[model samples]
Target: MEKKKNLLLDIDEVFCFPGFLDAINEFLESNYVLDDFSDYYIDEAVIPQERFNEFNKFLDSRNLYENAQILPYAKEVLKELDFIYNIYPCSSCINPFNIIGSGRLFADKYNFLISTIPFIEPEHFIFTNAKYLFKADIQIDDRLSNLNENIETCILFPSYHNKTISNDELIKRGILRAGYDWRTGWLEVANILLDQSQIKDDKIKRYLKK
Candidate 1:
């Protein structure tokens, strides 16, 4: 076997959809959805500055991270990718814009994976803003800011908030987007990143790697 490929997978938007945004919409009782993520920082994009206190309260009261719905194709895709890639649940627990007064944001995310994808070892979980620190063949994330020039292939997970980013800009940054059709996009990711030599073995791969 060749060297084990490193794949950095983001949790918040990539696998765990709507995360804090879902909680905020429910707490404010607003119809705002993920598409409303026009601004990079969710604070400026979604909630008003005045509502920060209530936002903190909402996060404190509910285990949003633990309860947030998993994105479609996430479970099956990750399991499939595991055969060809060392999956790392790379995510940032603390919101940079929000003060994060309530510690639930950090702890809940950790437990969220424990409950959701228990197959991914806890040691592979990373929660930090320093995404560039992780060495990987490819990094999948929704936010472009988390990526850098180092990672070989930075696959931008398309979302409502990031629809406006132009293709030229993404190419300039050496980022690849699989369009908004995430289910197909994920399969494409597995195909593109999976080692080509494993053609015969890929077919025989089981859902749960033994």
Candidate 2:
């Protein structure tokens, strides 16, 4: 039997829609949605520099994933992908604002993934910001910078921050965009990876080569 490929899958924005934005809204008493900001760091975009520390204080007092909901089709598609790829849920859990207490996130996210996705072994969980270190057959992440070149297939899972990225940029870097809408990104990913025949097709093949 052929060995399953290694898949480095991102947790936040990819597997689960984290509640950071919601938290920001709650803290500021302002209703700001995904489309409100194009920056990956929503707090920086919405909150003033003077209020940054206070925002950090607010984040420190709560579990960021408390309201996080798994992205649509994430579990179903991941379960199917698990049959062909070893799913490693890699996440960057550090709360940069509260670096000293960032360890709290590790446990919070770990428990969340364990309770939500029972199919993946706990040993496969990776919590690190240095994603470039992991050499896998496929790397799916919302952050374009996190998609390392060494990986055979690099999929940029669309998020608010990456919406402005041009197709030319992705094609030049041999990366594929799952789609622009985070609501249906997982389904798009399933289409791209589910069929082996599609991998060798001109579009996928063209991007994978470079």
Candidate 3:
């Protein structure tokens, strides 16, 4: 049997969409969506500088991943990919607001992944803010900065904050752009990693729905 290549998969925006934005909306009582911010950190973008501490306090008191939305096709595609690649779900669990209580996030995120992706081994989970420290055959992540150059295939997953990254920038860095839209980005990713010829048109069409 051929050795399956190592794939470092980011858990947060790449697959599991955290409820930070929802928390922000409820806290501020402002109907802000993902498209409302150019900044990577949504709280930093909308929260007033003066009330930042209060906002952090609000966040610190809640589990953001308690109701995190699992991105469409994340489970299905990842399970497919797992047959060909060893997937390691890497995530940054630090709460910049409450570093002292960051350990709780580790448990929260771990339980989420464990319950959701039973295919992936619990031992394969990696929690750290510094992702560049790891090297693998492929790395998929929402933040361009977190995609390590050492990885053979660095796929930049589409997100609201990273929409500004041009194809030229990605090409310059030898990274692949998953797609412009996050809704169906997984289909684009499936085309990249899976055998394109085998991907049924119907399968692609099902996920393209708005």
| Candidates ranked, most accurate by TM-score first | 3, 2, 1
TM-score of 3: 0.92
Model 2: residue 76 alpha-carbon error in angstroms? 0.9
Span of 10 residues, lowest total lDDT, candidate 2: 201-210
Write candidate 3's Cα lDDT for 59-152 as tens digits: 7778878899998888888877888899999999997877997887898899888899999999999999988898999999999989998888
TM-score of each: 0.82, 0.91, 0.92
Tens-digit lDDT track for model 1 on 1-210? 887688899987778764667676777787776665566566566678898777776666677665676776577667767777788989877754445553667788888888888888899998887887888888898888877669898998877668888999999988988676554555555555554444334442332223
Better of 1 and 3 by TM-score: 3
Worst window of 10 by summed lDDT in candidate 3: 201-210
lDDT by residue (1-210, candidate 2, tens digit) is 988899999999899977888888998899988877898888888899999998888888787778798888788778778878999999998887789989889988998888899999999999998998999999999999999988989999988889999999999999999989998787788778876443433433333322
Which of the predicted structures, 2 or 3, would earn the higher TM-score when compared with the native?
A: 3
